[model samples]
Target chain A: MMTSTDAGLPALIARMTGDEKHAAASESTLDVLWVLYDRVLDVTPDTVHDPRRDRFLLSKGHGPMAYYAVLAAKGFIAPEELDDWASVRSRLGQHPDRNRVPGVEISSGSLGHGLPLAVGTVYGLRAQGIGSKVFVLVGDAELDEGSNHEAIVLAARESMGQLTAVVIDNRSATRGWPGGIAQRFAIEGWATATVDGRDHEALYEAFTTPHPRRPLCVVAVVEPKSGQR
Target chain B: MDMRTTFLSTMEEALAVDPRLVLVLADISAGTGPVLAAQRRHPDRVLNVGIREQALIGVTGGLALTGMRPVAHTFPPFLVERPYEQIKLDLCHQGVGAVLVSSGASYDMAAAGRTHHSAADVALLDTVPGWTVHVPGHPEEARRLLLESLPGDGRVYLRLSSQANARAHLGAGFLTLRQGTRGVVLAVGPMLDRVLAATEGLDVTVLYAATIRPFDAAGLRAALGEVADVMLVEPYQAGTSAHHVGEALADVPHRLRSLGTQRDVEVRQYGEVTDHDFVHGLDVAGITAAARAFFR
Candidate 1:
């Protein structure tokens, strides 16, 4: 019952192994990345560097293979670049370097760092009166970084409508940190929507719609199956 | 020069010259009366991000990224500690030039207790890349440094004290207090007064380093010239400042010494004390005593 788009993902993941696969597996949240790249996002390989293009920042930057895979699939990068990943003098490393990689708006690997940068980018675009939207993907574990809470609170307070903070709450932080996923952002007055991450239709709807009153928080809850990785 | 007065004067001057120079404040603007008045005068430019420290810094970086020169004000410890990642990744890494006005340095917040004290900010922020750390000893220097940083590239941390007294004028590079220097004592921030007072009758040169991170090594060596002993006095940790001075004067036959508190006290008690008492508590006097012990 697998679709053609869904069938291509596992094969792409299969080609990557060892530490690369392990890293990519953590970004199983890429089901959303796939939806964004293939369907929702208004970006093209030719217009990757265009200022008018929508900006996407991978805040949870540890598992870069998923991003790399999506970029390669989108023709933004060559498939051959995957071989040189994490290699010496290679542009592809553990994290995405915007200078080395194309279509990356900001270089990020550190947790809780991207939201504020995204906020800044959105604010910049608003000042220039540019209609470009900014999308940032943050991991649930990054909620532990108080800066994220600070950013969410400010976004809501400022009513920054163009900023969309996508939280991949896979329940990973529960293994280590206190507090549940929703409670942290709810206190900030952000309009949050929790969705099954693997659902493509719901994600597409959540991403494209504009929230004029408040900052939108889409917490995609992904349940990892046993023996999946 | 008293930095508080200089900061207020320069801000007023900058506002007069260019109306675009926006002063953003957190919810704590009432504590900074003059700054709050400036905000009231230029209501369009002044923005309050409430008590959210991280958002305040991030918004400032965002505002600066869009060609607005934002002077974000906050308490020292929370300003650096709360949104440290934002300062590093969002501001520094992205090459945004925003002036961070930190009001509490060392024991400036002694009345507010240890939680408000920003003794470790200099040492912590100095390590971050593309950051210019400026601690003006007095107000005139504060004015010069603030005006200089306004139109410059990259991020700068302006550490201001609550004390409102003028001391000495700071020039470009290191200023040598005495000429015939057998030994040199380098001091940064408000502690220069103590170091200068300590070396009043002594045959030693006192080098007041206005800019700490991009330290003037050649100037420090040129000033120290054949001096046998080298000492660093700070209200924060000695590792960062002492190491920089040591590296700058490596060729010279000199030994480096540092004096500051290593850890915060465990108790949560708060009390009022003069700047001298606060410095003494951090062994600033003891460090000077040790320096004199070696030099004499």
Candidate 2:
């Protein structure tokens, strides 16, 4: 089993290469995942069940090689498990399952489930008076689903200060949102920011910026899915 | 009070006592008496998340994931059908549990048209596993079932309706109300009183079921005497539990008859709840005619 003492993100992700259809999907989330797990999130393998720990929900769960790699790099899972990710005997599947994988907050492959769940998680923590922060990662295309809009409206309206939605925009959406994706969240009363997805410092600064009483939306703009950054 | 009212009032009580409980809504009954007061008192605990049903269920699952036992309320179509994928993946697949309390059994909002009606709720839920379904016939029964479901973290769907029996049967499995020698008639939830009234002079055993998901096959088998003729009177779509009946009586030689709302045809014309019931052959006269034809 590969541990924290071994290979880095690129090598870890490359180990689980065969049969992965959406390499772009996994690649687009690489820096954001590394930044969140490595720098931002307060969770570790031991605090998976801790009520007060920050939550990271991967709403864009398709082509999860990068996510698995980051989890392995952060010591949430055994690095060796990535060797047989999609195998019949492996706990890891194409999409992540929270039950099988430690530190996964919600099991998602469906397009629009993550943001709504994150909003709820924020609401739950606020209700219990716990100040745990929640971060959800969604693809720009996944926002087309009406369910995400419902959550977008709600999270801002409720002023869920503890929630952060990081939209990984690879410019892959079918009918792209006019005036960009950040406006969609900004108009709905969310605090919005757009940053270079691949630049680690930009991603980190955008993530930690404070927006009290308002849910924050950080759009990590990456190269289009057709090109490499 | 109605079943909806009973559910709200009971939830209000639960919120006051349990710190782990949360109430999520989709503006369905947010402005009403108990809900309004509960929301005022427990602002954090009671949430009214606009009219978004998909988000309503997704949010419910999220709360459950945090170890909070959430009870989400809305109409049947919105609660059970609209965001079924969320129910499948978020709650069931996540291995977390919440109490899904839905009003409007079948066509409770008769004039609201087909969009509001959801006879396929239980049938659609049947497609997924690990759900305990309760079709409560009266407000008191709805209260009792909600109380029973709240203490534990399990996936429980409590179907509350405006159409109700005069009294409540608070037991699980099939409860035998009347005995006979000819055949067995199972009345599910709100269909109990009508089934009893329809089969008054006939020689048949009538069974009542409020909890239908974990279909009590053992109870049904014990209720059956020498005669293996069985008839099911359900309040939802026809033959919803026919498979359960078939599986329950797999060894016995039996003839099964199912009577409920029509699945193939859409009755667009809406006037009254009773009118819809009659159109669906769930009224006393319709059930009587169908029961007599099968039993005799």
Candidate 3:
């Protein structure tokens, strides 16, 4: 099994073929996934359903190859399943299906949906008196959805310190829209931070030590290489 | 009593009974009627997420996740249409226990014009899985359904109106107003009062569905039983309830008659009218009259 210490996600992604590679190459989200699988998310193949396992929700789920690849590498699924990605019977598809995938907590693909569900999961855990942390990785473009802003404001008011919202910013907010989501989140009273998307250490730090009294909003600034796809 | 007053008093009673109950409001504060007063009485439990529909649903999902039962309120149109994805993915997909209290159905927002009127909420919500759609025709049913949703795990959409004084017969599943030898009339939400008034002294049974999603199939079959004709009355589109009943009772040799607004975008015009006028304009009266002709 490919372990977390494997060098560079790009090299690993290059080895993939068919829909899996195509999806991974299209977006720069793989770097964030690498950090999640390699060092941050505290889950093993055997302990995926452990009650105390940290939950990760892919809010920006359009290109799911990054998630599939990380899961496959982490031995969550066999590597051969990546070839059937987006097929009629494939568990790996354009969007994440929580029921089909063991590690997935909620099915997500539509923009502005993951944050609220993540919030709900956090709330559910708290209600059951479960102290497990929830990490939701959302695309910067998803902030254009008014619901994301609504969730941000509410999370702050509730002081949902256990929930960490990481905004993966490839700087792809549609033209003319205000792109300063980090600033917006900070203004709303969340404990905000930013990091270079490709840096594993920075991503690890952000996920490991979330703010104790407020939700943590991390904007991972990234830029994909040209002709990568 | 105004339906709003009853709805609020019932909700406050429920809240007093359960510490987990929470009410989240959109921009419209005073407009939600008595529910607003309950929120005011319990400020810590009420969350106003401005006018954002999507965010309102998401935040409510968050609250539900944390062990709090969140009842989110918003304009019917915004709640059903604008934040639809949030409702579907966050609440239904995640299996969160969040109640969506939406005002404005048919003529509920007549003065606010077409933009505010939510004509397709029932039809839209019916398409979503695991979400119970409760279109309470009067105050009492609204109270009961709201109370029932408090301890449940799934999602609920309470389509309400500003008309507070509407009367409702209290019971669970389908309420039979009259027992007829022929097929029964299945009425949804507040339309129960209308069908009952229309069929007074006649030997026709009116089955009022409090929960639209699970839709009491055995209860419906038991009530309608070998009656060869079934008529459905609703404030939503014709196919909404009729289609589901037909699918569920495919083996029963019954002629299904549906009464509601036709599907036509051009016919969209907003105006001030009581529930009676809106139902009558949608040909509910004509359809009932036609059902009588078929019986003869």
Candidate 4:
């Protein structure tokens, strides 16, 4: 039953089943996570604790199957470990706990925490004069939490140049963002790009594009959550 | 200098020497001389996130994760309660630590009304694990506690108050200021001055505690000896530490009476701190009346 797209990443994701309450949430970020781990992030399993290594913070921590799959694919965790996810012995819980999981930056399940944490991560890195870029992945619906706005506005205003926020927009937020998700960040002065979420090359370009002296917001627009399997 | 001023100066000195120390503010004390100077001197380290408390805490967590020691400051309500989830998930759950220095403890900004009051801060933090709560009674104690917390990567909440004790009792454990045979009276932070004033002629042991968490059970037990009559005069919500007292005296037949800010009803009035103190039964006269009745 596997499609051509399901050969590599989706096959890995299929290993962790029976806890698909946020299947849409996880599916929406699969391409973005793969692109980041595989192509963009300058982090490896060996450099998880390296002070000079770039940090990838998963702010959208719900339905983290896609994230775990990506991490496993990139050799951060064993692919077999994904099978027992949410089980008693599994470090991969329903939500990611950074303490228990390697290569995971912040322990998050609560929405709106990741962006602020990511903003802080950049500031912290900047304070030490370590020029490590911090990337945070948040869901569009997650932005509804006012805490994210606090971070969104502050990050841009403070000119957190080293921070990049990838907001996965699947049109799931109850009161949908009025001018689209990218506009939200753009209005706050963050350098933004609205790329097709499933387009790998577009995502790569959006992420790699230079947006100096300000934080970057890459809105990967995916299929509406309701339209997904 | 007051505890608040001492906190700023101590933080400034720490920032000057320790590059790893980062101060994140939600525009609380962003304009103060020490803070402004520190920001000017070390722009990268001192961050004013512009009235965003949740972001302030989240930023602190981020800093700690990256091996920087972060000190986040604001009022209790804004700093603690407002961004509670951030404190829980971002810092504690993330397995990193930060020094959360909060001023305007309880009703310090009495004229600001209940919107600014945060009597439930310590009690709220009690719900989370691995937090070191320090309610310093004097400026010196606040300075010492802040200095002690900066170097270590641990969860610490240094609560500073406008109301202060005449003298600072510097110790991590409950220091027995006066020994008596009747019962043990434990006074936390600013409550010490009033507790002492209230128990001047009474034959009750007066113990001062700047550090409330890790509750200092052994010190409380040692102060009590065999007699189990204990009274806790705290500055935060009343009975906030009653559970801790119960746990400490689980095996002993101890009688406990707790005195602190009222829990059942909000004062609903903006007045002087003295008025709020009297209303909460935290003033000298209120403490004397409560102590005499309970001890008798």
The lDDT leader among the candidates is 2
Candidate 2, A92-123: lDDT as tens digits: 99999999999988899989999988988988
Q: Which digits, one per residue and each the tens of the lDDT, describe model 3 over residues B28-108? A: 654565556666676556556677777778878767655678888777888878777777777777666688888766666
- DockQ of all predictions against the true structure, Cα-based: 0.40, 0.81, 0.48, 0.88
lDDT per residue for candidate 2 within B169-257, as digits (tens), equals 88767899999888899999999999999999989999999999899999999988779999999999999999999999999999999
True lDDT of residue B208, candidate 3: 82
lDDT of 4 by residue, B115-192 (tens): 999999999999999999999999999999999999989999999999998887886699999999888999999999
Clashes of each: 4, 1, 11, 0
**Residue ranges of candidate 2 with Cα displaced over 4 Å:** A1-7, A18-22, A227-229
Q: What is the interface RMSD of each candidate, in Å?
A: 2.8, 0.7, 3.4, 0.6
lDDT of 1: 0.71
**TM-scores of the first chain across all predictions?**
0.88, 0.94, 0.87, 0.93
Per-model C-alpha RMSD? 4.2, 2.5, 4.2, 2.3
Docking class of 1: acceptable
- Model 2 interface CAPRI class: high
Where is the poorest 10-residue window by lDDT in model 1 chain B? Answer: B275-284
Candidate 1, clashing residue pairs?
B1-B138, B1-B139, B1-B167, B2-B139
Candidate of highest DockQ: 4
Docking class of 4: high
Return the lDDT, model 1, position A119: 73
